[model samples]
Target chain A: METRVDGRLVRGDQTRRAVLGKAVEIASVDGLEGLSIGRLAKELEISKSGLFAHFGSKEELQLATVRAARRIYVTAVVEPALATAPGFSRVWALSECWLDYSQRRVFPGGCFFAKASHEYGARRGPVRDYLAEVNREWVQLVEQTIGEAISLGELEADPAQLAFELNAYYDSANLASLLHDDDGAIYAQARHSIRARLESAATAGTALPWRSGRSR
Target chain B: METRVDGRLVRGDQTRRAVLGKAVEIASVDGLEGLSIGRLAKELEISKSGLFAHFGSKEELQLATVRAARRIYVTAVVEPALATAPGFSRVWALSECWLDYSQRRVFPGGCFFAKASHEYGARRGPVRDYLAEVNREWVQLVEQTIGEAISLGELEADPAQLAFELNAYYDSANLASLLHDDDGAIYAQARHSIRARLESAATAGTALPWRSGRSR
Candidate 1:
């Protein structure tokens, strides 16, 4: 059954979602700075005043777009990895899903966070602060996942350092794919790099994550 | 005596240099697309037509800025590394120089190429093509440096793979610096990673590069 809500509220929510969907796609390629309410409104066939009512200012619009991207990022990249068991296997799944998300053009550019982070990382303001917070959230998730493996005795390394390298591989591959016209092999190379790094850190009896379908 | 040049040509050269100098700084903080003739003219207090004549178009201005950045990059990062005797030492020197360049805020952003490349990586245009070329040149130079180390028998590893990982560290550290407010120690951690990786591949009796002040 549909949740009880005013018809006007439902329509407004739908419109907001539609705007953000287009917003994230534009920001992914042209950057958050490139996202303009006027262009977005025209493209969405909505009134500029209508879109402006959803977000009070350009900065607000950018922040909302970042939040929208975060939700998609969670669904496409994070939730699937979290669905797996917590440990090295889950961490491996996270990398795989991230690579898939980028190469599949989930955002029609690449990872939204990577693009926005670089865009705002050098700037100052509420937008930069929010993007940094999102970045911190993502990095912490990666570190925590690695920590699970270390606790399980499946891996041996500093969680922060491994997180850094793993995240680096993800971003490098994302940028490389964009530059190379979504060349599939870049993802493979990233996978190889991830697998090699993980293999180097895996404990002697730990099952390698890449060799799937074998009973532990 | 002043180098002889046509009086009109000298003024033209001076204007072009001044325009490019501001262009690189703005492009660094705001990406190449953020740079516009209007902004350049307003900021430099030059007429719009004057700035427009220097580059002819926004795309040409971006390419000229990239070229200007390249010259700065060569002087700041590449030349210092090249001055050293080639081989493992030069590879080590290149890493140090790159890290230093980023830490020193050579572009007032992070790395110029990193910012511009991420800006245009997904978009198809002369800007993206030029960025890709710059990226290829940087990566190939890195590979050649690694090759020198391998050929000298001081290091043993696949040059391509090593180049990828090393460049990854450089770019990662640069981005992390932006995110972390130029936290000086990220470079140290990246240095540590670079050293550890090199140590793993280094042959017996090869002196560690970091143990400096000892004449080679």
Candidate 2:
């Protein structure tokens, strides 16, 4: 009896994961407001009642989709950057990974947060609050990474200011690429800006990450 | 008969202008997809058939809204910048105008293009095409303004690259301000980055725009 219950729970988890996998892709293309439980159920071949049992409200589903996108973001952009040595190289890695994440269409439509944040930015709600929290978290991470380079004497700048600039490049490239149906030129432009900004801040005699023979 | 017909024509024009004004506001906040003829008619107290006659279709309305937004953008951001001398100060004016446009909430939600572009970016349609065209137009304007500064020998940088970086800062600040509901700190950060970048590119003898006591 215990085994049967455990099996049911695992299956339920699988279904929920699969549903959110589809949900994030849709939300990336369409806004989170475009997410409809009926449509999701129809697309996923799940009964509407089953979806309701999983997510009691549209807000809940939207929140879950955001959470799912966040996990994918961390894996695709954050984890690899963190794997690098904590200094100028790691900062470069973060930029490279982010460009790849957007260019490669990891979220199908583009960066999930870019789309979702603009969608819900003006509206006041749980979704907006959550997205704001996520953005704050991201900015802090970038600032922290830059601080590592500053502390190591490899770079010199205000971490918060530099982080804001780096993030701007990432988002601009993502939007330009998506809007223009670009063929990689936008990402190249973004890379140029990121490298130049980092170079401007790197201390003299410090080995630049992009210029060095080291792979980032 | 001529007088009556002219009066009717003038009234029709007035109604169309009013409808588009409201439409742009709605699109800025809720996105173009959220603009519904029924809702507009109900809110504006016009007959649905009247709106249908004016717009003909949802696509037409969205396209018209975009056009209207472009006009407002030119007035709010472009014209003011163009009024400045065509040099480093013009480029600086452009940045200041754009930041003001977003900061002052000219569209009540934010820069209409920033929000609308992200909304329709991934989707393929006439709306997306129109948005892409507008974005291209805006980028070219920035590039042209930067070229003027470079030609005047007041700045030294790649026009396209500098345009991309400056525009990135404008958009990033707009998004950050909206998401965080900031108290003007985001704009200050963007201003610092913009000034620093331009200062790096400015020729030694060129007078800095922001630093001068000129009323900008």
Candidate 3:
């Protein structure tokens, strides 16, 4: 027997998606705390109570926005890197994709985690806790990717330390680009740092993934 | 003739200093936008009107807070570095003092600029403009210090690029430390990166400032 669709569930899911999309955009500019049901409803031309009904409270809305941002982040940064085979190529792809994601304004305000993490980092609440969790998850992903390259004998370095330095370059470039409004040079600097670190870590006889003429 | 002493003027100045100190502290955690006259008055046990009289408005209050934070920043980071003589010593000292300032929780939240810059980065306002100015002033200072080393023939590197990389490491470590409470390893990692960069930049005949085991 065929099952019938629940129209209410389908409508709620559609509304939830729409609300979250706007939530991430607003949070990108104003911050998660600055995001409000009234403002979001006014912008979306929906009733305040309707938006509140979906989120239940401001904190819930912020949490849902964080989740939505994570999905976008994975699609923009992680999925592209995953398409490359696991090794040095994947690591370089991840860095390039991340810089491109920020430079291309995937979120229209730089990296969502960079903005939101700095926003809630020092404050205490479910929002701050959730952000901290996301940060840990991202760093772990970087470290694991480095570990894969090292295990494959393509690179030889402390995965954790290399991951930390690479990530530092990524975020530093992102903030500098936003702060200075000079995007052209910042990404080039980041790419230089990433290539230098990887070159130092690459094992003997292994091809440098970022060399000028090398094919990945 | 001596100028007439006004108790009200003295009281107002004292109150203004007190208010600004607390404002920077709160803004470090919440943000300049999160700072409100009502909240400041309630927390400081002063009348809202009295605080308003001193600042005149929220915009004025934010401006004053930024100035106050700058003063604290200079004291914590610049003064200590300036105590050392110009050259690689001063440049290294500046980096050490900066890392210590963040690690010691000088602002009780983290680096004040890191928080404030990210907060107003994507938005347009006096606050964002002020932060942008501060960032330029800071980068210029780093470049100037490096230029001193270059002039003395103690180092060989592009000042602008070196400053960018060093500043990147500083901020990356700050964010990582805040995000990972259990990770005391970030500070060490940042120091390693700094030392490596400095070593690579140091002229062959020059002495290494960090080689004396002065301990960063």
Question: How far in Å is the alpha carbon of B143 misplaced in model 1?
Answer: 0.5
Tens digits of per-residue lDDT for model 1, A1-216:
887879999999999999999999999989998988899999999999999999899999999999999999999999999999988899899999999898888998788988888898789999998888888899899999999999999999988888888888888888877886755877887888888889899988888777876844
Clashing pairs in 3: none
TM-score of chain B of each: 0.95, 0.95, 0.95
lDDT of 3 at B135: 91
* Docking category of candidate 3: medium
- Weakest ten-residue segment in model 3 chain A by summed lDDT: A207-216
10 residues in a row with least lDDT, candidate 1 chain B: B207-216
lDDT, residue B52, model 1? 95
Q: Which stretches of candidate 2 lie over 4 Å from their true place?
A: A1-5, A214-216, B1-5, B213-216
Candidate 2, A79-173: lDDT as tens digits: 98999999999999999999999999999899999999999889899999999999999999999999999999999999999999999999999
Name the regions of candidate 3 deviating beyond 4 angstroms.
A1-3, A212-216, B1-5, B213-216
* i-RMSD values for every candidate model: 0.9, 0.5, 1.1
Give native contacts recovered, as a fraction, per prediction: 0.49, 0.81, 0.68
Residue A153 of candidate 1: its Cα lDDT? Answer: 92
On lDDT, who's better, 1 or 2? Answer: 2
- TM-score of each candidate? 0.96, 0.96, 0.95
Error of 1 at A45 (Å): 1.2
Evaluate every candidate with DockQ and list the scores: 0.70, 0.87, 0.74
What's the true lDDT of residue A209 in model 1?
Answer: 71
